[model samples]
Structure formats: structure tokens, C-alpha cells
Target: MIKWIAAFLGYFLFRFPGAVLGFIVGSFLDNFGGSGNRTRTVFENVTRQSVSPADFELNLLSLCSIIIKADGQVNQRELDYVRQYFLSTYGKEKANAIFRTFNQVIKKREISAERICSFMVQRTRYEVRLQLLHFLFGIAQSDGQVSKAEAQKLKEIARYLRVGQHDFESIMAMFIKSADTAYKILEIEKTATDDEVKKAYRTMAKKYHPDRVVTENEAIRKGAEEKFKEVQKAYETIQKERGLS
Candidate 1:
């Protein structure tokens, strides 16, 4: 009853994620109704929507497959990277299940970027989606260089996911190295003063901090930490170049 109510209210107020969050909270409330004490639900974050592990894995693999196929021919390294990352993060059993689903469903059919982004926008948090973009960039760069086709596809995916231009550029900078890459990672302009650069670093540090991704799994939080480090590196690089160091 409570779950249904949350689903209704959440859908009306938010969207897919709202419903998921409602259900998770509802489960807690329902359980509380029966017993005085409450227990935690296994959906990634406590403050965010509860995306089932299985479902999240399936959809995530689907997205990876899309990226792998984006550049015409698939690279063994890219495929191995995805498999190895999942294996290390989720463990053998879960990774096996994820691959099974990938082969049976995701690998077989061509899932549209629109469909994936639509689900992500409605059901997931902005932070998670940002991490997703970062992961895709990793795939594009796995073959040593990100092809023009792969880069274009990544941009399309980011747009579909409703990622802001600055944020998109920020993630893109982490993979595509250039003279102004530092500024892009900080999501700032090149002409910004020292103070402004520091400010951007602080904002980005807080935004990409692993703590912000507590609702996600350990692997994903680790990924956030990696992103946070990139932001730190960018800031330091800028500081040195500008003689602030």
C-alpha cells in the first residue's frame, strides 16, 4: 500500500527515479509497520532511487555494448576492459550473471541510445549518469585513441542523458587531452583568474567526491574517487602553469 502510494506520488513529482525511490522508502515503511526496528534495503544509495542490482547491471552492459559497436569494429581491449572491470567490482557470480544477461538480451538486440537515456533521466541521479559518461569515455579511449565516430557517439549519449554542456566537456576533457584540458575538467573558462580557478576546483571536487556517490556500489564510488582525483590533477596542473604553485 505504501509502496504503491510512493510510486504514484513519486511518478507525479519526479519520474522513474522518484518511483524507485518511493518503492525503496515504502519497503522500509512497510517493514517498520510490522516490526518496530527497521533494516536497510539493498538498493544502491539510501538518499536516492533503488535501482535493482540485476537491472542496473543489465542496462549498464547494454550501454557498453552500444559504445563498443559505435566505432564500427569492436576492440578486444575494450570488451576485456568492460568484462574485467565488472568482474573486479561485482565479483565472479554477479559478473557471470551480468554477462549472461548481456549475451541473451543486450548483445542480441540493438538498444537505442534514446531508450537508455530516457530511463537514466527518469530513474537515475545526475551524478550516476555523469559517472556513466565517464565510463563510456574510458571505453572510447581504451583502444589508445578515441576515434571520431566514438567521440561523436559519446557526445550524442551525453546529450540524450541531458548532461549539461559544461559537465559534458568536463568528462570529455578527462579522456581527450589538450592544452585547455585542465580548464575543461574544471568546467571553467581559460581566462578565469587564479581565484576563479580555485573556486571551480572546489565545486568540482565536492561534486565528484566519492562521498557524493555513497548510494552507489563500492566500484562506482571508487570510480567517483577517480574522477575527483582527475579534478584535483587538473587544478594542480593549472596552478603550476599559472605560477600559482
Candidate 2:
């Protein structure tokens, strides 16, 4: 049993050093090397507590910085967009602190979007991942358009996060408006009838509804609300174009 636990810890320690360390140190006195049942319980508790809201925000901002630098130059529009998002979501005091920390982290090392996305996929909920994708699109389009480099980087991050093509395209459509973007945003075929479009819109809205997000964090809920609004706009655009409303 100890061998099994050690092996498990060893595997995760490389990938999640901080979490594994906390799990080990925090459980050392209480449950380390205890009965199998007690050890299992401690393991479950530690796993559940591994990723906190602060951790999520840091990873998100770090990845956002990576996207901002994808085009080889950080434009003022991208920086302004990030600052505004942080201020709105986290408030001025917290946002300023987080923004400073993120800038320092980015300057210290080159972050790998794949690594960040992989970590997020393992730690975050699906709804949170979708919201992160929405933010990524926002960053990509901050400078008026998503350059080829930025678009490809976003695709790579999406793939690493295990986001489906439909979801990726749906979020992309929200940022890059076009004749068929509304249909793509709703994940419906362009040839679909009015009823089919309506059905698709309803299903997507339900899936992305802000209330569907299970987090207690207001920032996360606010992000989800934005996504919900984007979904609503897509449906409205489609209906108006087809004269269905």
C-alpha cells in the first residue's frame, strides 16, 4: 500500500510539485502511512483541494499572456484588453496585483500554452475550460483581428485542452463575425431549417447558461455570463437573418 501511494505521489510530484508537496506535508501527521482506508480518504481530500481559485486565475492569466505574445509583439490593444478584463473580473485592487504578478512570471520564463492547457484540462471544469477558450478568443481578436500565428496558437491550446472542434469553432465564431459565424456559434449546419436552428440555439444556451457553472467564484460566474450572452447574440443574429423572429 505504501509503495502504491509512493508511486502515485512520485508520478504527480513532477507535474504538480506544489500540490503534491502540500498533499504530502499536510497529510504527514494525520494519514500518511495509516490504514489503507484512511490513506485513501486523505488522498481524495487532497486531490479535491489541489486546484484553488487563485491557481486557476494565475494559470488563465499566464496563458493569456502567452497568446498576447504569439504574434511576436505585444500590442497596446492586447494589453488594454487584458487589463480591462482583469479589472472588471477581479476588481481594481486585486486585478492590479494579479496583473503585476502575471507580468513578472511571463518575463521570467517562456510559458508553454500546451503545458498550461494540459494543466487546466486536468484541474478545471468543462464550463471553466469553455470560458477560458472564450477569453483566449477575446485576446486573439483584441488587436482588431486574430493573426494566422495567433489563430494557430489558439488551435494548439484548444487541442491540448481536449476541447472539441465544435466547441472551438463555436467560440471562434463569437469573435470572428461572418455570414456563417452565427450558425457555427450555435454548432448548427448552415443548411439547417429554422426549427433546427432554434433547437440548436436552445440546446447550446442551456449548456452554456451562467447558472450552469458550479463555482462560487463571482469572477467565474461573470465570465460564464459573458459566454451566455455571446450564445444569445448568436441565436438572435441567426433568427434576424432568417427572418424567423
Candidate 3:
């Protein structure tokens, strides 16, 4: 019922994540409906939908499922982490509803990580999925340490996401020396004078400037503000390196 509703609504009615939730919940209800057919029902409904393939929601859910099941047990703390993150990053109302729905659906089943990943691969893209991989790594590190299971899951996700081997290695690398954070970011160098810094700032200001961000969504605008700060930090760091105040 939940998966069907979410799938029907999200795919047919265009309700975004609501549909995804519907699918997950519906399957749970169907299998456990005082009978034992929810599994079959969930599988059928999943087979019915096709548009949500690979990139966005599908891959996200798949990766999350793997992470949660990595240690052979999913704890309340991890669940809380995911819930809080969704609430903060997405929205409170949606997060609350999703949590309730998922609890109602998956409280019984313990599906394998491989099953989730199989479904995920069917929906996500092969490239640029490292961003999602990095997100998982960040979440796993939220507790001040990463578990062995988390590390294994990260490697699997990295492979599935097709992140370059070098990029994967550098994901853990730090403090070699950027040499020219400014030049790397702005395509300018140390020899470039104050005027050059000003020019670089100008170009970067245009590139990372908050005003340039589309303001239709206030949330998106805030993200732009963060990006703007990074740009400012890089420019200032460069300027200070050259004693330019």
C-alpha cells in the first residue's frame, strides 16, 4: 500500500519523494498484512516503476539502506542521524512523515544490502555519483570515528559510483600543500600582483557571488551564501599569503 501509493503518486502524480515513501511503506504493509505477501507485493510494485531510474532519489535510498545495514545491525543512533539530517537538509515536515512511514513499513524486514544496491544501480548514473559517496562518508564520520563496515560500504559505493581511483585515495589525503589555493581556484598565481588579486577577486566574485545565485528558492540562496564564503576564504587566504592584507 505504501510503496504503491508512493510510486503511483511520485511517478504518476509527481509528488516527488512522497511517491518514494509510498513505495517503501506500501511494500511493508502488503507483506506483513496479517499474511506473508508483502515481500512479493513490494517486489512487484518496484518492478512497475521505471522513470526514477538511477540518479537522484533511487540512488539515495539505495546508498542509505546499505549504510544502515552495513554492521549487521541498524541502531537507533544511526537512525536518528539519518532522520535529523533529512529534517535539517530537506525539511522537517517531510522528514517526520518519511520516518513515520518507513517505521511502519520496514520494522519487520531485514533486506540484504546487496538487494538494495541492485535496485540502486538500476536507477543511478555512473558518473558524478562520488558526491553521494562523499556524503555517506561524511555521515559515517559524524560520530568522530568510521566503522570497519562503514569503510567497506564506502568502498563498494565508490566502486559502484565510478569515482576515479585517484580521487578515492585523495578523499582521505590532507595537508600535502596546495601550493596555490588561489591560482588553483581562480586560475591566477603568486607572481600576479595586487591588481591581479583584485582581478581574480573580481572574476571569482562574479563566479561565486551570492547575487549570481538564482533567488527563486531561499534555501538554495543560503547554500549560495556558503559557497560565497568559501570563495571569499580562498581569495583572502591567497591575499594574506602574498602580504596583501
Candidate 4:
């Protein structure tokens, strides 16, 4: 939710600055940009009304709490990353409003991970779920490195989200670098032929293309673009190792 959602929200808000503030649960805070800006109404309604805010909070916010608790201790860096991300993307007023709602959700009841993941797998698109994992890894790794406990929790979440092993490993390689990370990110064997390597790079590039998630918010698209960049980096690493053109 932080990275993808933040990226997409920032991108769309830029294009339509007015529609961005409508996210507040009730009333425009501190007033609108100007009396002349006509897009103000659109800003409030163009996004997420189709998707229930309560439902969105219950799932994504719940996941954030679980990740913050994953490594046996809550890290303030992770907390700040989540907070600043929302504040920067949604603006102070909206972000504070979201935190209010989030706090309410935490206080009122518990939403099981099984049900949350089930809702995600059944309701959200595959590409979005992929970005969800991408964002989750970002959270886990925010404090510098993802601990073993955090990594295990991530794996469990991936399985619950029904992410394939190859896809899961590909995303994992982006955060947890290793000698063979390039190969894993590209989903290819190091023993593959030169042509196979080229083909894998092409496939990954296409698969992670930002356009593939066009329907996603600007933040999700940004997350997809980051994966696309990682794919490019992985290809470059292999190319340099093998001296491919």
C-alpha cells in the first residue's frame, strides 16, 4: 500500500490536483484550493469510491501492522516510512484522516489474515497482488535489511496471496540481493544459453511493464515500474557477467 499506492496517488494527484483531497472521510479540510478550480469535485469522487475505504483499510492497514510486528519488534523506521508515505501522497489532512480511521479499525476488532488474503486473491487483480508483495517487501526492508523472521513472514503472506514460487522469488531478489539474484529475478537458470537469457529478459521486461497495470492507481503503477527497473538491472548484471551485447 505504501509504495505502489503512494506512487499512483502522487501521479494521479499531479494530473488532477483537485481530485486528490476527496479521500477524506468527511468534508474538505481547511477549504479547497480556490473558488475557480473546477476539478475539485472530481478530485473527491474520481478515486476509490468504487472501492470501499473501510474494506481497503481493513486489509492493507492490517497487513502493515503484521509486517511491522513480523521481526519480533516494531521498528520506528518502518513506522515512519508508512506514515511519511501516506502524508506525502495523500497530504497531511487526508493522511491524518486515514490514520484516524486506521486507529479506529485497530481498536474496534480484528480481521484475520486468512480472510484478508482471501479477499485480496479473489477481489484484486494478479498484477495488483504482485505489487502488494512488492510493497510488503519494501516495508520489511525499510529498516535497512529484512530479518530472517520478516522474510519468513513475507513468504507466508506470498503463499496466502497465492503468488507462484518463481514470481515470489523474483520480487524477493529485488530486496534481498545475492550473487545469483540476477538469475532469480529473471526467472532463468545460470546454465541457460545466451539466447535464453535474452529471451528471459524480454519476457520479464514485458511482464513488469507499468502499462500492464494501467488500471491501478498511480502508486501501484510506480511499484510496477520499479519492478520493471529491477528487471532491467538484473538483465544488465547478467549481460556484464557474460559480455552479451
Best by TM-score: 4
1-245, model 1: which lDDT tens digit per residue? Answer: 76567545544443333344444345444544533211222122323454444444455676788888887787899887677665544458856866776665534546767776776687656765776687678777888988888889999999999999888888788778888999999999899999999899999999888777766333345557677888999998998999985
Query: Which ranges of candidate 2 are over 4 A from the true structure?
Result: 1-58, 84-109, 209-229
What TM-score goes with each of the models?
Answer: 0.65, 0.63, 0.45, 0.70
Residues 1-245, candidate 4: write the lDDT tens digits.
33344444634533222112222211122123212232222113223324344444445667777787877776889877667656766679877876776565444334455656776676566666776777778778889998998889889889989999999999898889888999999999888899999999999899889888665344455567767888999899999999999
lDDT of each residue in 1-245, candidate 3, tens digit only: 44454345433332223233334434444554523322232233343334221122333444565676677766666676557555543357756755654564344355444544455456443322433454566556555566788777777767655566654543422112256644555556568878988887787678657688654433234444544675677678876777776
Q: On residues 53-136, what C-alpha lDDT tens digit does candidate 2 reach at each position?
A: 344455667787888888888788888876765554435896788777777655645776666666666665665576667667
Candidates 1 and 4: which is better by lDDT? 1
Worst 10 residues of 4 by lDDT: 18-27
Candidates 2 and 3, the one with greater TM-score: 2
Candidate that would win on lDDT: 1
Off by over 4 Å in 1: 1-55, 89-110, 193-228
User: Which ten contiguous residues of candidate 2 have the minimum total lDDT?
Assistant: 38-47
Clashes in each model (backbone N, CA, C under 3 Å)? 3, 0, 14, 8
lDDT of each: 0.69, 0.66, 0.51, 0.67
